[model samples]
Target: MRVMEAALVMMSGEAVVVEAPSVAAGFEALYEAEYAAMVRLARGLVDTTEQAEEIVQDAYTKVFDRWNSLKEPGGYLRTAVVNGSRSELRKREVRRRIGLDRPLDSGPDERDHMVDALAKLSPNRKTALVLRFYADLPEKEIAELMGVRPGTVKSTISRALAELRKEIDR
Candidate 1:
């Protein structure tokens, strides 16, 4: 009976000692695996690579905090990075609207203008565009992430592209 009790204790102790991966370790793996791709994705959504880097880092921090709850961590992180870049762009637009800041550049080919045009769009449209173009996600994936129908994603992308065309023509 004593030997049986000792065996149970040893088994339970070993079970308790088996640890899951740490959040930091998970985040590091995610960062290493996706950082460059995220930066490139963000660069298309933001004005500069520096801003893109900052946005990606902010997204990673958020992912770190919510790692355990994430089902598809990579997809979540990508969406978070896109959302973070969009948020930064929105802040810049607000500043521009309030006369708190000047347009960063006037170059026609510069991404700043493209980002500015995107900022003028509705959040849903902007999100759709980012997910479809920058993230290279399919319409179904964009709809899934945006919590909308695939038809809505299609319409949003159409409108966003029209807006971009008008901006480019200016």
Candidate 2:
């Protein structure tokens, strides 16, 4: 019953109105609006820009697949991005352990102090800190996205900040 109107231009310069179902239209709008932010979120969690882009694309695909039934598409998409980033990190760790991947040789002085400090934190702590500070999400929302209790998020962030302070002081 819900419809969205879009304008299409003909080769001859005539304009025509097209009606799309609200579901598809809504998804299109969401993709346009949140794609950049989602990429940034993934970038915060992942090591490379390419990986962040891939993770965000995968998240969008998952969101598109279940858009109609989703209760909160934005939140679901965010969770998907976070999960994808976590999976990628896990795969990289396995590769490193199996000798298929070499450790990055960049020295601490070559990177921004804050970024280096964050990279040294455990995945959970880094994720909590990124979601809370970089993404600027509230604690409750971060808890839902990270699939942990709010109290756990609070503690993780507290520990992460302490660790960051110590790392930066060096």
Candidate 3:
């Protein structure tokens, strides 16, 4: 059984075979492989599971919209998720500043010190830490995703780790 059809064309005298995966088929495979991981990535960067799911869904919609044009769909999807998470955090901050945000009353059983410390971090620091630790991304890749220099990513991660240590110590 052929998964994709190969076409042969003659450039000079020798024939060249070219095979292309169907857009829908490729996208389905990508979604199946990356959906869970993408959601996890988003969850690390966002406040709630619901927001993570929404961010991932929106990223998938964006990836599917430009699937054929993307050179690297996975990278595009990652960038989209990071951007979406950043936007969500900014909106949340705006609401908090405007007194439109409500506080969560977590029981002692649900309160996680590390999570609380992470939430207290600035968005850039939080993003740098999440991408470095949770995603296990290299400084270069994290820099690319965060649109910063590798040196900046290095310093950000260092400072974030120090801050996390201080926060958790308290």
Best by TM-score: 3
- TM-score per prediction, in order, is 0.71, 0.79, 0.82
Tell me the spans in candidate 3 whose CA falls farther than 4 Å from its real position. 1-21, 103-109
> What lDDT does the true structure give each of the candidates?
0.75, 0.82, 0.85
Clashing pairs in 1: none
What's the CA error at residue 153 for candidate 1, in Å? Answer: 1.4
> Candidate 1 on 15-131: residue-level lDDT in tens?
533224465466667778899999998877776789989988888878766777988789888778777876876787788889997756636665465677775675567777877
Q: What TM-score would you give candidate 1 relative to the actual structure?
A: 0.71
Rank candidates, lDDT, best first: 3, 2, 1
C-alpha lDDT of residue 108 in model 3: 82
| Whole-model lDDT, model 1 | 0.75
- Which stretches of model 2 miss by more than 4 angstroms? 1-20, 105-110
Error of 2 at 106 (Å): 6.9
Query: lDDT tens digits, residues 84-139, model 2?
Result: 98888777778887999875544555667688788767778888999889989999
lDDT of 2: 0.82
Question: Given candidate 3, what's the lDDT at residue 32?
Answer: 89
Runs of candidate 1 with Cα error greater than 4 angstroms are: 1-25, 106-127
Question: After aligning candidate 1 to the native by TM-score, how far in Å is the CA of 52 from where it should be?
Answer: 1.2
Candidate 2, residue 42: Cα displacement in angstroms equals: 0.8
